[model samples]
Structures are given as C-alpha cells and as structure tokens.
Target: MRVMVFVKATEDSEKGFAPTPETMAMMQAMGKYNDELRNAGILLTADGLKPSSEGKRIAFDGPGRRVIDGPFAETRELVAGFWLWEVKDMDEAVAWVKRCPNPMPGPSEIEIRPLYEMADWQE
Candidate 1:
C-alpha cells in the first residue's frame, strides 16, 4: 500500500515564520524516522514544502481564466509538506504516521491516506 502523509500548515506558516530551533530539531527527528522507514524499505519519498505564498492557483471556466497567489487560505489546517510511503497496509501506514513528531508549533495535524492502486481499478 502507498500512503500520503500530509503535514498541516499553521497561521505562522502563512505569515512566513521560519522553523524554530525546537521545530528544526523535531524535523531532524522526522528525518531519522524517514531514514528508518527507508531502511525498512517503506519510504518512497518525503520532503517539506516552501510557504504557500510562493504557489499559484489557476481557475478556469468557459474561456475565463484567473490565477491567484498564495498564502491562499487563512485556515490553519492546510498542507505544508507530505510524504509518500509504501507499506503492507493501511494499518502500517497509520503506524508510521503516528510516530511522526508534530510538524508545527501549535495545533498541527497530519493526515494519512492510502493511495489507490491500479489493481484496485481493475474489474
């Protein structure tokens, strides 16, 4: 099973707050977890993302086009980073995600979802 682990964004993240020393240390711990996953042959890829301010959102409708810039949302529950990992099942994916350090300073969240396999689409 392949899973996507979402690293949620915070208010400070939208305002371009750099990671604090404690946050950086937590990230380092995450890196160690990633390394362990890789060694166990589960992790496919993982990385943090730049602030959403650098991103662009495109909207299109019937020949009308618009592009909007980010820090798009005022919500704290936005994606800031992600990890793609292969595991035996959803349970394993959940276990890995459970072990991750909180990625944000306050009220952070991580969402883990299994990726759809092509075989699942076959009927």
Candidate 2:
C-alpha cells in the first residue's frame, strides 16, 4: 500500500520561523529514519514545503471568474510537508509514522493516509 504522511504546520511554520536547534536535530534524525525506509524499499519520495505565505489560493465559482489570494487563514492545521511511502498495510504505515521526530517545539501532528489505488475502482 502507498501512503502520504502529512506534517502539520504550526503557527511558527506559517510565519517562516526556522526550526530551532533541537528541531533541526530531530529533523536530521527523521532524515536518517527515512533513509532506513529507503534502504528497506518503502520510502518513495519526501520533502518539506515552504511557508504558506509563499503560495497562492484560487477559488473558482464559474468559468473565467475567480478570486486569488494568499496567506490564507484557518491554515493553522495545514500540512507543512509530506512523505510518499510504500508499505504493506495501515499498521505498517502507523508504525513508520510513530518513528518520525517532532518538527516543532510544541505539539506536532502527523497525519497518515493511504494512497488511492486503481484496484479500488475495479471492485
């Protein structure tokens, strides 16, 4: 099975604050862990995203009419990064997620969701 691990962003992340020394160390550890996954042939791709302020959001209600802006609110829980991984099952994915290091000094949240499979439509 394939899964995406979402690294939820905190206010600091959205504000472009760099990770602290401890956080950087944790990230390094996580990178090593990801390397382990790659060695085991599970990790596919992984990367962190820039601050949301660097992105834009577009809302389209109809053809040729749209509103575009950025630094959206209610984004406190948005994903700051993600990892694409291949695993055997949900349990395996969960185990891998549990091994991730916290990305922030405060509470850090990681959401794991299975990737959609074409076989799902065949049934």
> lDDT of each prediction vs. the true structure?
0.81, 0.82
Which tens-of-lDDT digit does each residue in 1-123 have in candidate 2? 999989888887788756678767877887888888899899899988888778876776766665555576776568788999999999999987887777666887888998789998895
Error of 1 at 104 (Å): 1.3
Best candidate (score: lDDT): 2
Candidate 1 per-residue lDDT, tens place, 58-107, comes to 99998999999876766566778888988898888888778777777777
lDDT of the structure predicted as candidate 1: 0.81
Q: Provide the TM-score for each candidate, comma-separated.
A: 0.87, 0.88
